[model samples]
Target: MEHTGPDAHPWLVALEQSGLGVAMRQSLLLYPAVEILHIFGFVLLVGSIVGFDLRMLGLAARLPVAPFARHAVPLAMLGFCLAAPMGLLLFATEATSIAANTAFRFKLTCIAIGLLNAAAFHLGPWRSLLQRGEVTMAAKLGAVVSLLAWSGAIIGGRLIAYL
Candidate 1:
């Protein structure tokens, strides 16, 4: 697909021409290193989230939900910290093309849905359930949704290379 000219936003042009973007595209070692870091970050992020969701699904029923969240939430947030900037840098390296990619768009949509689902859980049933130390149908449903959304996001991200 055509990615440049008037179709490309000014910000995307600037990003493509920026020093970091140029370096990321041009430097063999840097690009691979960045990709590796991105992989690690997402691995941590998704792994932690899925693990936590499994816990909510009764994998470790003996463990208190609140305490599990205390550990899991921070780990997931740390993974986000690691992943998000690296992902942005990777995007900046090929902004226009990635922007036009169907898989990329789907991946972003899944991420948004996943985040919204998480927020709804925390804001709604999860808070009270955590306090009460009881799992509910709603909580389990949220866990299922979280697992599906994140898994879909990961799948979409992987498909970016082929699609």
Candidate 2:
């Protein structure tokens, strides 16, 4: 999967050659530290998402959704803030190989779909659920999709090293 010389994508090669990428590859501590941060970020992000999705799916019928979301969403955003930059740095370190990696591609696709699903749910049925104090079918569907997409993302990410 390692693309070199004329076989490699120009932009990816350039990214791998960038100062940040060089540093990431050369530094023993930096890569592991960034990886730990990345893992923590994903844990926070996915944990919050799963908790909220479970609430939407009727796990906590007593507690309100809006209040939970108000707390969870910020944590998810914070997680994203931590994850995204570290993820970029990680990718830069091996842009050529990773961009060609099937698992990496799948993980990226899942992330995109999951984010879109969240955005759509929030913009649409989420508001309805919050305003009416009722869980709509769309809300339930959104929760299911979120769970599947995020799960797929995690699996795909893990498989990247092996695949």
Candidate 3:
């Protein structure tokens, strides 16, 4: 397969010339609706994970970590799934700049780490622990990792526009 240079991608040029991006380029409101959707999705994810993770870490709710995790997993998944498409939408509008940006690379790396963390949690011992309706050391560890990954993803994403 022939790889296209970043500058040569037709998609990138289209995005750069998109009326939406060009119109709001100067205002903080650029892609306001898209950004809003992204934020809303992230908040949902935070709400789901935070609540579940905290409960696993001995917070209120006293939910069996397994059950709590079960419910929270969907929300976390939803949040991430929604945010990803929205993020990609924004990136499409400026792929050339984003691809060369350090913050964007970092954001992508963090997301990769997050996905790996989730997969590891799913396939490792935490899976059985979660099945038992009690939090184990592994569960706590996973929760901490989840918190860090998601938090880092958020920070990296926010920094994208700034940096």
* Highest-scoring model, lDDT: 2
lDDT of 3 by residue, 1-163 (tens): 1123655567766666677546545456657878888898889877897787677678874556666667888988999889888877677666667766778888788778778877887797466775675667776787788788778888888887788
RMSD of each: 1.5, 1.1, 4.7
Query: Which lDDT tens digits does candidate 2 get at residues 1-163?
Result: 4466687899999999999989999998999999999999999999999999999999988988889999998998888889889999999998999888899999999999899999999899988987898999999999999999999999998998997
lDDT of 3 at 60: 78
For all candidates, the clash counts are 0, 0, 0
Q: Write the per-residue lDDT of candidate 1 for residues 1-163, one digit (tens) a residue.
A: 3387678888887887799889988898988888888888888889989988998899988987887888888888888788888999988887877888899999999889889988999997787796787888888999999999999999999998888
Error of 1 at 130 (Å): 2.0
Q: Of models 1 and 2, which has the larger lDDT?
A: 2
Clashing pairs in 1: none
**Candidate 2 global TM-score:** 0.96
Model 3 weakest lDDT span, ten residues long: 1-10
Question: What TM-score quantifies how close candidate 3 is to the native fold?
Answer: 0.78
TM-score of 1: 0.93
